[model samples]
Target: MTKTILITGASSGIGKETARLFQAKGWNVIATMRNPDSESELSTLENVWVTKLDVLDLDSITKAVNDGIQKFGGIDVLLNNAGYGAYGPLESFSRDKILRQFNTNVIGLLDVTKAVLPHFRQNKKGLIINISSIGGKITFPLGALYHGTKFAVEGISESLHYEVEQFGGQVKIVEPGMIATEFSGRSFDFSNDDSMVEYQKIVGALMGAMPAMAQNASPSSVVAEVIFEAATDGKNQLRYTAGEDAKMLIANRQQYDDATFIGGIKAQFGL
Candidate 1:
């Protein structure tokens, strides 16, 4: 029987590309997003079902999972790829924005994972691929809240792996660095305050350097391919880096002490 994979945030970027790649490989694709009606591409593909699934909405999460299973017989993989970055100075972040970042990136991911757990537990075989970031393992300026959410994901996935292993379920994290996607554009949130002139200057400098940082970034499709490997590799691999930059940076981080690693990041951004 052909396997099925359910992906969140399938309207664009890595999720969208992964849905296409899996469909191309003969897997049933449940390509979910917040506004399924607005999606024109994935909805038209064969073996691909575009459905509404807002990770923050528990009802939608359960509905999407059920809908996928109902249509495809069973879901073999769950790709938790719905998330966004909240950038800018921590002081400039309002209470709502900070909460929103955590709610969407961390809490929402957990909810979707919870919704799929029963099915996985019953099947005794399943894979969960979380679209974490290089930020999960390291930090950068203007990304305190975003990094916090990713770090939470890393820790949560690590702990959950042990619990699920008893039943043959697996968890894998994909860490992509500066992928060329709307994630750095429309999907990104930037906070600022006119009253905070010093912060404005600092944020401006950081934002200015972002384009250069992303110039050598890999495309979203590259990350999609990595996710595909993580899902099908059938190994006990817990973490996979998606880009050369991610691999290099993460390797450097592992080799260096905390102070040295942090200093390298500061030097990279001219901090």
Candidate 2:
């Protein structure tokens, strides 16, 4: 049988690359994004369907899932890859921005998972792959809110596994370090307020280092490959860390105590 995978936020970056890789691997891909009309290349591929899906909207989530199942006969995997980074001092963030961040990154993820649960449960087989981040486990300056959401994802995925496994469904988390993508550029939202001058120096220093960090980062295709492996590996593994930076950081954090890890991170970022 030709298995299908429905991916959210598939317009660009990791989501986009993952869609392409899966299609190349002969999987039917439902590439859902906020603006499907704007996508050209993915729609041109065989066994690939580009549809509109906004994770924050329940109707869109349900429709995207149904559309994929209808077109591909059945969906074998669900990739929760629709999210963004909302970074910067928490104090600089407005109430609306904070809510939006959680809505898109955390709440939206839960809703999509809920929409797909019945299908997975009824079919007795499915894979849920969440695109979390190294930030989910470790924190950095000005990433409190972003890290909070990813941590929520980690906790949610861990708990969901116990329930889903009873029905032959599996949940996997993909934690990728800084990748060279729009995620570091246009996809990132940085909070800044001129009135909060006290935090400017640290914030500026972090922002200054981002371009250089991105230069040394891995490509989106690398993370895409990891996602593919997680989907097809058929192992009971709960987490897969992508990129050398992510592997090293996760290992280093695990080897050190909280204080030591915090100190190491601060020193690395020159804080």
Candidate 3:
């Protein structure tokens, strides 16, 4: 039987790579993004359906899921990889920006998962892989909003597993460190008020450190491989960390207390 995987934010980065990987492995892929018209590569692939799906839009979520299921017969896996990084100080953001972050990352994920649950329930088996970040377990200098949303994803995926497991559904989380992608380009949102003098030092520090930090970024393909493993390994694992940096950082976070961990971050940021 041919299995199908539905991937959100599949126009680029880890999502696009994962779509290609699964398709190559003989799985039908529904590669969804906010604007499918702009996509050229994945659309040309066999057994890959490129469709429109904006995470903030519930109607689009439902329609995308239904359309994919219909196109591929049935969806065996769902990869919730549609989210951007919202950085900068919390106070610098407008209400709309704040709401957009939470809505897209938190509420929108729940809505998509809700739409897919019925199909999984009917089939008696399914896997949901959420693309969280290393930040989900540890905080950065100016990622309050971004980290907050990922933290929410961690909690949500953990709790939802218990409920979904009763019906043979499983939830898995992939925590990837800095990935070599356009994530810092079109997918990144940074808000800052220059007039806010208090945040200048930390902002400058983060900006200065970014280049060096990016030097060690693992390619999106690395995370894609991990996603493939999570989908097919069929293990009872709940969390999989991708990238050497993510493994080391997550291990440190698990080993250290609040003061020690936070102090380490502060020292790294020159705070």
Candidate 4:
């Protein structure tokens, strides 16, 4: 069978790159995003179907899955890659902003996974690949909301594997460090209240460190390749770290205790 992969947030970044990679490798791709009408590139691909899927909207998620299955005969893999980074001091966040962060990143992922469970269960074999981040294992200043959601993703994927594995289904997590993508642009949300003078210093520190981080960022293609590996390696691996920085950070995290690891982050940000 020519296997099909359904990807979320495929309009740009790693999602778009992965869709292209899979299609080039002869796999059918259902490249979904919030606005499909604006996508011109993926829509032109032969085996790729560009569709609409907003993680915050359950109806859109379900419809995207069903429509992809119908178009490609059955989805063999589900790539939960639709999420953004929400940064800033926790105190600066509004109730709605907090909810939106959680809804789009954590809750939305669960909902999409739930919608696809039946299909995977019936097939008795499937792959669920989630795009977590290095932030999931290590925190940075002004990243409470983003890190919280990614940490939730890590836990969910790890625990969900236990349940799904019994029926030949597998769940995997891809932790990418910092890919050169538009993530810092349209996909990033930073909230801050300047009136809260206490947070200004840390905000300035974070802003200053960002440019250096961008300079070290690997291309989105790097993460896309990691996702491809997880999809096809057919190994029982639970997690795959993408990018050189991701590997180094994950290793350091494993080698350090809470205090040491946190101190290193503080030093990096000059906090």
What lDDT does the true structure give each of the candidates?
Answer: 0.91, 0.91, 0.92, 0.92
What tens-digit string does per-residue lDDT give for candidate 3 at 69-188? 888899999999988898898889999999999999888889989999999999999999998999899999889999999999999999999988999999999999998764477668
- Please tell me which model should have the higher lDDT, number 1 or number 4: 4
lDDT for 78 in candidate 1 is 95
What TM-score would candidate 1 get against the native?
A: 0.97
TM-score of each predicted structure versus truth: 0.97, 0.98, 0.98, 0.98
Error of 1 at 70 (Å): 1.0
Worst 10 residues of 4 by lDDT: 179-188
Clashing pairs in 4: none
TM-score of 2: 0.98
lDDT per residue for candidate 1 within 50-74, as digits (tens), equals: 9999988999999999978999999
Model 1 spans with C-alpha error above 4 angstroms:
none
| Better TM-score candidate (1, 4) | 4
